[model samples]
Target: MLRYQVVESFLSINGEGKRAGQLAVFLRFAGCNLKCSYCDTMWANQPDVAYTWMTKEEIYEIVRQSGAKNVTITGGEPLLQKGMKELLAFLAEDESLTIEIETNGSVDLTPYLSISDRVVMTMDYKLPGSGMEDRMNLSNLKKLRTVDTVKFVSGSREDLIRAVQIMEEYTLRGRCACYLSPVFGRIEPVEMVEFMKERQLTGVNLQIQMHKVIWDPEMKGV
Candidate 1:
Protein backbone atom coordinates (compact mmCIF):
# COMPACT_ATOMS: atom_id res chain seq x y z
CA MET A 1 0.00 0.00 0.00
CA LEU A 2 1.37 3.41 -0.99
CA ARG A 3 0.83 5.88 1.80
CA TYR A 4 1.08 9.64 1.46
CA GLN A 5 2.59 11.94 4.06
CA VAL A 6 -0.34 14.25 4.48
CA VAL A 7 0.39 17.37 6.51
CA GLU A 8 -3.22 18.56 6.62
CA SER A 9 -6.61 18.20 5.00
CA PHE A 10 -9.44 20.69 5.19
CA LEU A 11 -12.36 22.27 3.43
CA SER A 12 -11.63 25.82 2.35
CA ILE A 13 -12.23 28.10 -0.59
CA ASN A 14 -9.26 28.12 -2.98
CA GLY A 15 -7.32 31.28 -2.16
CA GLU A 16 -5.90 31.54 -5.68
CA GLY A 17 -5.89 29.96 -9.13
CA LYS A 18 -8.65 29.75 -11.76
CA ARG A 19 -11.00 28.33 -9.09
CA ALA A 20 -10.19 31.02 -6.56
CA GLY A 21 -12.91 31.75 -4.00
CA GLN A 22 -14.70 28.50 -4.79
CA LEU A 23 -15.22 25.82 -2.16
CA ALA A 24 -12.63 23.01 -2.35
CA VAL A 25 -11.29 20.12 -0.34
CA PHE A 26 -7.61 20.84 0.14
CA LEU A 27 -5.19 17.95 0.68
CA ARG A 28 -1.85 19.45 1.65
CA PHE A 29 0.95 16.93 1.40
CA ALA A 30 4.10 17.20 3.46
CA GLY A 31 7.67 17.92 2.15
CA CYS A 32 9.01 20.00 -0.73
CA ASN A 33 11.99 20.11 -3.08
CA LEU A 34 12.49 23.89 -3.32
CA LYS A 35 12.39 26.42 -0.49
CA CYS A 36 10.95 29.75 -1.60
CA SER A 37 11.85 32.77 0.54
CA TYR A 38 8.23 33.86 1.01
CA CYS A 39 6.83 30.37 1.58
CA ASP A 40 3.79 30.71 3.81
CA THR A 41 3.68 26.95 4.47
CA MET A 42 7.17 26.61 5.85
CA TRP A 43 5.70 24.89 8.88
CA ALA A 44 4.39 22.13 6.68
CA ASN A 45 7.82 21.55 5.14
CA GLN A 46 9.90 21.39 8.31
CA PRO A 47 11.87 18.19 8.95
CA ASP A 48 9.93 17.57 12.16
CA VAL A 49 6.53 18.54 10.83
CA ALA A 50 3.79 16.24 12.13
CA TYR A 51 1.84 14.37 9.49
CA THR A 52 -0.62 11.53 9.03
CA TRP A 53 0.29 8.71 6.64
CA MET A 54 -2.76 8.09 4.48
CA THR A 55 -3.62 5.70 1.70
CA LYS A 56 -5.37 6.75 -1.48
CA GLU A 57 -8.68 5.39 -0.20
CA GLU A 58 -8.36 7.28 3.08
CA ILE A 59 -7.57 10.49 1.22
CA TYR A 60 -10.48 9.92 -1.12
CA GLU A 61 -12.81 9.48 1.84
CA ILE A 62 -11.78 12.83 3.22
CA VAL A 63 -12.48 14.55 -0.06
CA ARG A 64 -15.72 12.65 -0.59
CA GLN A 65 -17.02 13.64 2.82
CA SER A 66 -16.11 17.31 2.46
CA GLY A 67 -19.11 17.89 0.17
CA ALA A 68 -16.99 20.13 -2.03
CA LYS A 69 -17.01 19.54 -5.76
CA ASN A 70 -13.59 21.09 -6.24
CA VAL A 71 -10.50 19.29 -4.92
CA THR A 72 -7.07 20.89 -4.55
CA ILE A 73 -3.94 18.80 -4.03
CA THR A 74 -1.51 21.39 -2.69
CA GLY A 75 1.70 21.15 -0.78
CA GLY A 76 4.93 21.86 0.26
CA GLU A 77 4.84 20.60 -3.41
CA PRO A 78 2.28 17.89 -4.09
CA LEU A 79 4.14 16.26 -7.00
CA LEU A 80 7.09 15.27 -4.82
CA GLN A 81 5.00 12.65 -3.08
CA LYS A 82 5.68 9.03 -4.10
CA GLY A 83 2.80 7.26 -5.82
CA MET A 84 1.16 10.57 -6.69
CA LYS A 85 0.07 9.23 -10.04
CA GLU A 86 -1.74 6.36 -8.36
CA LEU A 87 -3.38 8.76 -5.93
CA LEU A 88 -4.50 10.98 -8.76
CA ALA A 89 -5.76 8.00 -10.71
CA PHE A 90 -7.77 6.90 -7.69
CA LEU A 91 -9.19 10.38 -7.18
CA ALA A 92 -10.14 10.67 -10.85
CA GLU A 93 -12.38 7.63 -10.49
CA ASP A 94 -14.85 9.95 -8.79
CA GLU A 95 -16.34 11.68 -11.79
CA SER A 96 -18.08 14.38 -9.80
CA LEU A 97 -14.95 15.86 -8.28
CA THR A 98 -12.97 18.46 -10.20
CA ILE A 99 -9.31 17.90 -9.29
CA GLU A 100 -6.47 20.41 -9.43
CA ILE A 101 -2.81 20.03 -8.56
CA GLU A 102 -0.83 22.99 -7.19
CA THR A 103 2.78 22.26 -8.11
CA ASN A 104 5.98 24.23 -7.70
CA GLY A 105 7.53 24.50 -11.22
CA SER A 106 10.66 22.50 -10.38
CA VAL A 107 8.87 19.20 -10.87
CA ASP A 108 8.45 17.71 -14.32
CA LEU A 109 4.75 17.77 -15.30
CA THR A 110 4.98 15.37 -18.24
CA PRO A 111 4.41 12.24 -16.13
CA TYR A 112 1.20 13.57 -14.58
CA LEU A 113 -0.22 15.01 -17.80
CA SER A 114 -1.44 11.65 -19.06
CA ILE A 115 -3.17 10.62 -15.83
CA SER A 116 -6.52 12.16 -16.52
CA ASP A 117 -8.01 15.15 -18.25
CA ARG A 118 -9.92 15.72 -15.00
CA VAL A 119 -6.57 16.43 -13.33
CA VAL A 120 -5.99 20.06 -14.27
CA MET A 121 -2.86 21.81 -12.99
CA THR A 122 -2.05 25.18 -11.41
CA MET A 123 1.75 25.36 -11.64
CA ASP A 124 3.95 28.11 -10.28
CA TYR A 125 6.85 29.74 -12.07
CA LYS A 126 8.94 30.81 -9.10
CA LEU A 127 10.18 34.35 -9.75
CA PRO A 128 13.56 35.87 -8.92
CA GLY A 129 12.36 36.82 -5.46
CA SER A 130 11.61 33.18 -4.67
CA GLY A 131 15.29 32.21 -5.04
CA MET A 132 14.14 29.02 -6.79
CA GLU A 133 13.89 30.36 -10.35
CA ASP A 134 16.76 28.31 -11.69
CA ARG A 135 15.18 25.10 -10.44
CA MET A 136 12.12 25.59 -12.64
CA ASN A 137 11.58 23.04 -15.42
CA LEU A 138 11.01 25.29 -18.44
CA SER A 139 9.78 22.36 -20.50
CA ASN A 140 6.61 22.31 -18.40
CA LEU A 141 5.55 25.60 -19.96
CA LYS A 142 4.89 23.95 -23.32
CA LYS A 143 2.90 21.12 -21.69
CA LEU A 144 0.16 23.38 -20.29
CA ARG A 145 -3.26 23.07 -21.86
CA THR A 146 -6.01 25.65 -22.23
CA VAL A 147 -7.59 24.42 -18.99
CA ASP A 148 -4.36 24.78 -17.04
CA THR A 149 -2.93 27.88 -15.33
CA VAL A 150 0.57 29.26 -14.90
CA LYS A 151 1.03 31.48 -11.84
CA PHE A 152 3.85 33.90 -11.16
CA VAL A 153 4.20 35.03 -7.55
CA SER A 154 6.08 38.31 -7.57
CA GLY A 155 7.71 39.95 -4.57
CA SER A 156 9.53 42.82 -6.30
CA ARG A 157 9.61 44.91 -9.46
CA GLU A 158 12.43 42.82 -10.88
CA ASP A 159 10.41 39.68 -10.28
CA LEU A 160 7.42 41.20 -12.07
CA ILE A 161 9.54 42.19 -15.05
CA ARG A 162 11.00 38.70 -15.31
CA ALA A 163 7.48 37.25 -15.12
CA VAL A 164 6.35 39.33 -18.13
CA GLN A 165 9.40 38.31 -20.10
CA ILE A 166 8.72 34.63 -19.39
CA MET A 167 5.05 35.07 -20.33
CA GLU A 168 5.91 36.64 -23.68
CA GLU A 169 8.78 34.26 -24.39
CA TYR A 170 6.56 31.25 -23.85
CA THR A 171 3.51 32.92 -25.38
CA LEU A 172 1.71 31.85 -22.22
CA ARG A 173 -1.17 34.32 -22.54
CA GLY A 174 -3.04 32.39 -25.23
CA ARG A 175 -1.63 28.93 -24.41
CA CYS A 176 -2.98 28.84 -20.87
CA ALA A 177 -4.35 31.07 -18.14
CA CYS A 178 -1.58 33.36 -16.85
CA TYR A 179 -1.80 34.98 -13.43
CA LEU A 180 0.30 37.54 -11.58
CA SER A 181 0.03 37.44 -7.78
CA PRO A 182 1.81 39.58 -5.20
CA VAL A 183 3.71 37.82 -2.45
CA PHE A 184 1.48 38.68 0.55
CA GLY A 185 3.13 41.84 1.95
CA ARG A 186 6.11 42.25 -0.36
CA ILE A 187 4.49 44.31 -3.14
CA GLU A 188 1.30 46.30 -3.42
CA PRO A 189 -1.48 45.14 -5.76
CA VAL A 190 -1.73 48.57 -7.36
CA GLU A 191 1.96 48.44 -8.19
CA MET A 192 1.43 45.22 -10.09
CA VAL A 193 -1.61 46.66 -11.86
CA GLU A 194 0.34 49.76 -12.91
CA PHE A 195 3.10 47.58 -14.37
CA MET A 196 0.49 45.47 -16.17
CA LYS A 197 -1.16 48.56 -17.67
CA GLU A 198 2.18 50.00 -18.78
CA ARG A 199 3.14 46.75 -20.47
CA GLN A 200 -0.34 46.24 -21.93
CA LEU A 201 -0.31 42.72 -20.52
CA THR A 202 -3.69 41.72 -21.90
CA GLY A 203 -5.09 38.26 -21.01
CA VAL A 204 -3.02 38.14 -17.84
CA ASN A 205 -5.09 38.35 -14.65
CA LEU A 206 -3.94 39.90 -11.40
CA GLN A 207 -5.15 38.12 -8.25
CA ILE A 208 -4.84 38.41 -4.49
CA GLN A 209 -5.22 35.60 -2.00
CA MET A 210 -8.90 35.80 -1.05
CA HIS A 211 -8.52 33.55 2.00
CA LYS A 212 -5.95 35.95 3.41
CA VAL A 213 -8.56 38.71 3.20
CA ILE A 214 -11.30 36.54 4.77
CA TRP A 215 -9.24 35.09 7.59
CA ASP A 216 -5.91 35.77 9.28
CA PRO A 217 -3.03 35.32 6.84
CA GLU A 218 -1.26 32.99 9.25
CA MET A 219 -4.34 30.96 10.08
CA LYS A 220 -4.06 27.27 9.24
CA GLY A 221 -6.50 24.88 7.51
CA VAL A 222 -8.36 27.84 6.03
Candidate 2:
Protein backbone atom coordinates (compact mmCIF):
# COMPACT_ATOMS: atom_id res chain seq x y z
CA MET A 1 0.00 0.00 0.00
CA LEU A 2 2.98 2.31 0.57
CA ARG A 3 4.02 3.34 -2.90
CA TYR A 4 6.59 6.12 -3.58
CA GLN A 5 6.73 8.42 -6.56
CA VAL A 6 10.01 7.78 -8.32
CA VAL A 7 11.53 9.93 -11.02
CA GLU A 8 14.13 7.33 -11.96
CA SER A 9 16.29 4.52 -10.67
CA PHE A 10 19.69 3.79 -12.22
CA LEU A 11 23.33 2.96 -11.68
CA SER A 12 25.54 6.03 -11.51
CA ILE A 13 28.56 7.29 -9.66
CA ASN A 14 27.79 9.91 -7.06
CA GLY A 15 28.65 13.21 -8.74
CA GLU A 16 29.45 15.20 -5.65
CA GLY A 17 29.82 15.15 -1.86
CA LYS A 18 31.94 12.66 0.08
CA ARG A 19 30.73 9.65 -1.93
CA ALA A 20 31.86 10.99 -5.30
CA GLY A 21 33.29 8.34 -7.66
CA GLN A 22 31.67 5.47 -5.79
CA LEU A 23 29.47 3.22 -7.90
CA ALA A 24 25.96 3.26 -6.47
CA VAL A 25 22.37 2.71 -7.44
CA PHE A 26 20.55 6.04 -7.36
CA LEU A 27 16.86 6.10 -6.47
CA ARG A 28 15.62 9.55 -7.42
CA PHE A 29 12.30 10.37 -5.84
CA ALA A 30 9.85 13.00 -7.05
CA GLY A 31 8.90 16.31 -5.33
CA CYS A 32 10.66 18.82 -3.15
CA ASN A 33 9.64 21.46 -0.60
CA LEU A 34 12.07 24.14 -1.86
CA LYS A 35 13.32 25.24 -5.26
CA CYS A 36 16.88 26.36 -5.93
CA SER A 37 17.95 28.38 -8.98
CA TYR A 38 20.86 26.11 -9.99
CA CYS A 39 19.27 22.74 -9.30
CA ASP A 40 20.51 20.30 -11.92
CA THR A 41 17.62 17.90 -11.35
CA MET A 42 14.92 20.49 -11.99
CA TRP A 43 13.02 17.85 -13.93
CA ALA A 44 12.37 15.96 -10.72
CA ASN A 45 11.19 19.02 -8.77
CA GLN A 46 7.98 19.69 -10.63
CA PRO A 47 4.79 18.82 -8.76
CA ASP A 48 3.27 17.45 -11.97
CA VAL A 49 6.27 15.50 -13.17
CA ALA A 50 5.34 12.02 -14.39
CA TYR A 51 6.56 9.31 -12.02
CA THR A 52 6.12 5.60 -11.41
CA TRP A 53 4.78 4.46 -8.08
CA MET A 54 6.99 1.80 -6.50
CA THR A 55 6.82 0.17 -3.11
CA LYS A 56 9.89 -0.47 -0.94
CA GLU A 57 9.96 -4.09 -2.11
CA GLU A 58 9.91 -2.97 -5.75
CA ILE A 59 12.76 -0.52 -5.16
CA TYR A 60 14.78 -3.14 -3.31
CA GLU A 61 14.33 -5.60 -6.18
CA ILE A 62 15.75 -3.04 -8.62
CA VAL A 63 18.71 -2.45 -6.35
CA ARG A 64 19.35 -6.16 -6.07
CA GLN A 65 19.29 -6.53 -9.84
CA SER A 66 21.67 -3.62 -10.28
CA GLY A 67 24.35 -5.73 -8.52
CA ALA A 68 25.56 -2.64 -6.66
CA LYS A 69 26.28 -3.07 -2.97
CA ASN A 70 25.88 0.63 -2.37
CA VAL A 71 22.69 2.64 -2.79
CA THR A 72 22.00 6.36 -2.66
CA ILE A 73 18.41 7.45 -2.05
CA THR A 74 18.36 10.93 -3.56
CA GLY A 75 15.64 13.21 -4.75
CA GLY A 76 14.31 16.67 -5.29
CA GLU A 77 14.02 16.07 -1.50
CA PRO A 78 13.64 12.45 -0.41
CA LEU A 79 12.49 13.23 3.13
CA LEU A 80 9.29 14.74 1.72
CA GLN A 81 7.97 11.29 0.83
CA LYS A 82 5.62 9.79 3.41
CA GLY A 83 7.13 6.28 3.36
CA MET A 84 10.84 7.16 3.18
CA LYS A 85 11.38 6.06 6.76
CA GLU A 86 9.87 2.68 5.99
CA LEU A 87 11.96 2.33 2.84
CA LEU A 88 15.11 3.16 4.75
CA ALA A 89 14.22 0.68 7.46
CA PHE A 90 13.85 -2.05 4.86
CA LEU A 91 17.16 -1.19 3.21
CA ALA A 92 19.01 -1.11 6.52
CA GLU A 93 18.38 -4.83 6.99
CA ASP A 94 21.01 -5.66 4.38
CA GLU A 95 24.13 -5.61 6.51
CA SER A 96 26.41 -5.79 3.49
CA LEU A 97 24.80 -2.81 1.76
CA THR A 98 25.88 0.75 2.32
CA ILE A 99 23.05 3.25 2.06
CA GLU A 100 23.30 6.98 1.69
CA ILE A 101 20.49 9.47 1.95
CA GLU A 102 21.00 12.72 0.10
CA THR A 103 18.82 15.31 1.77
CA ASN A 104 18.20 19.03 1.21
CA GLY A 105 18.41 19.75 4.95
CA SER A 106 14.96 21.36 5.08
CA VAL A 107 13.07 18.41 6.61
CA ASP A 108 13.00 16.72 10.01
CA LEU A 109 15.53 13.86 10.26
CA THR A 110 14.57 12.57 13.69
CA PRO A 111 12.53 9.74 12.25
CA TYR A 112 15.63 8.26 10.62
CA LEU A 113 17.80 8.52 13.72
CA SER A 114 17.43 4.85 14.64
CA ILE A 115 18.95 3.74 11.35
CA SER A 116 21.68 6.38 11.36
CA ASP A 117 24.35 3.73 11.68
CA ARG A 118 23.35 2.06 8.42
CA VAL A 119 22.48 5.13 6.37
CA VAL A 120 24.85 8.02 5.91
CA MET A 121 23.04 11.34 5.75
CA THR A 122 24.78 13.58 3.25
CA MET A 123 23.00 16.84 4.10
CA ASP A 124 23.29 19.93 1.96
CA TYR A 125 23.29 23.18 3.87
CA LYS A 126 22.06 25.70 1.33
CA LEU A 127 23.98 28.97 1.14
CA PRO A 128 22.95 32.39 -0.24
CA GLY A 129 23.55 31.16 -3.78
CA SER A 130 20.76 28.61 -3.38
CA GLY A 131 18.22 31.14 -2.01
CA MET A 132 16.96 28.37 0.31
CA GLU A 133 19.37 28.87 3.21
CA ASP A 134 16.62 30.17 5.42
CA ARG A 135 14.68 26.96 4.86
CA MET A 136 17.53 24.76 6.17
CA ASN A 137 16.83 22.79 9.34
CA LEU A 138 19.88 23.85 11.36
CA SER A 139 18.98 21.40 14.10
CA ASN A 140 20.00 18.55 11.78
CA LEU A 141 23.59 19.69 12.08
CA LYS A 142 23.61 18.59 15.70
CA LYS A 143 22.36 15.14 14.74
CA LEU A 144 25.28 14.32 12.46
CA ARG A 145 27.87 11.73 13.38
CA THR A 146 31.30 10.87 11.95
CA VAL A 147 29.72 8.63 9.30
CA ASP A 148 27.60 11.50 7.98
CA THR A 149 28.56 14.62 6.06
CA VAL A 150 27.39 18.25 6.05
CA LYS A 151 27.94 19.98 2.73
CA PHE A 152 27.93 23.65 1.75
CA VAL A 153 27.74 24.61 -1.91
CA SER A 154 29.60 27.85 -2.52
CA GLY A 155 29.17 29.90 -5.70
CA SER A 156 31.17 32.92 -4.64
CA ARG A 157 33.67 34.18 -2.09
CA GLU A 158 30.82 35.55 -0.01
CA ASP A 159 29.24 32.12 0.04
CA LEU A 160 32.48 30.54 1.23
CA ILE A 161 32.74 33.10 4.03
CA ARG A 162 29.23 32.31 5.18
CA ALA A 163 29.99 28.57 5.06
CA VAL A 164 33.04 29.04 7.24
CA GLN A 165 31.05 31.14 9.71
CA ILE A 166 28.40 28.45 9.98
CA MET A 167 31.08 25.77 10.31
CA GLU A 168 32.60 27.55 13.30
CA GLU A 169 29.27 28.52 14.80
CA TYR A 170 28.12 24.94 14.73
CA THR A 171 31.55 23.45 15.43
CA LEU A 172 30.62 21.28 12.48
CA ARG A 173 34.11 20.04 11.69
CA GLY A 174 34.43 18.58 15.17
CA ARG A 175 30.95 17.16 15.05
CA CYS A 176 31.13 15.38 11.69
CA ALA A 177 32.68 15.34 8.25
CA CYS A 178 32.31 18.81 6.69
CA TYR A 179 32.65 19.48 2.96
CA LEU A 180 32.80 22.70 0.91
CA SER A 181 32.00 22.23 -2.76
CA PRO A 182 31.82 24.92 -5.42
CA VAL A 183 28.72 25.38 -7.48
CA PHE A 184 29.59 24.18 -10.98
CA GLY A 185 30.33 26.96 -13.49
CA ARG A 186 29.80 29.62 -10.81
CA ILE A 187 32.96 29.16 -8.74
CA GLU A 188 36.11 27.31 -9.67
CA PRO A 189 37.04 24.33 -7.49
CA VAL A 190 40.58 25.68 -7.17
CA GLU A 191 39.20 28.96 -5.89
CA MET A 192 37.38 27.19 -3.09
CA VAL A 193 40.51 25.19 -2.25
CA GLU A 194 42.65 28.34 -2.13
CA PHE A 195 40.19 30.04 0.18
CA MET A 196 40.17 27.03 2.47
CA LYS A 197 43.92 27.00 2.58
CA GLU A 198 44.11 30.72 3.28
CA ARG A 199 41.69 30.41 6.17
CA GLN A 200 43.60 27.32 7.43
CA LEU A 201 40.23 25.65 7.74
CA THR A 202 41.36 22.20 8.73
CA GLY A 203 38.97 19.21 8.67
CA VAL A 204 36.88 20.74 5.88
CA ASN A 205 37.24 19.16 2.43
CA LEU A 206 36.94 20.73 -1.03
CA GLN A 207 35.27 18.47 -3.59
CA ILE A 208 34.25 18.78 -7.23
CA GLN A 209 31.46 17.09 -9.17
CA MET A 210 33.35 14.05 -10.47
CA HIS A 211 30.53 12.53 -12.51
CA LYS A 212 30.08 15.73 -14.49
CA VAL A 213 33.75 15.60 -15.42
CA ILE A 214 33.54 11.91 -16.36
CA TRP A 215 30.57 12.35 -18.67
CA ASP A 216 28.80 15.16 -20.48
CA PRO A 217 27.53 17.58 -17.88
CA GLU A 218 24.03 17.40 -19.33
CA MET A 219 23.76 13.64 -19.61
CA LYS A 220 21.17 11.87 -17.45
CA GLY A 221 20.79 8.26 -16.17
CA VAL A 222 24.49 7.48 -16.14
Candidate 2: Cα lDDT at 203? 85
Q: What is the C-alpha RMSD of each candidate to the true structure, in Å?
A: 0.7, 1.0
Tens digit of per-residue lDDT, candidate 2, span 62-115:
999998888999889998999798899898888878899999999978888777
User: Highest lDDT, which number?
Assistant: 1
Per-residue lDDT value at 123 in model 2: 92
Alpha-carbon shift of residue 62 in model 1 (angstroms)? 0.4
Highest TM-score: give the candidate number: 1
* TM-score of each predicted structure versus truth: 0.98, 0.97
Q: Candidate 1: misplaced stretches above 4 Å?
A: none
> Candidates' lDDT values, in order?
0.94, 0.88
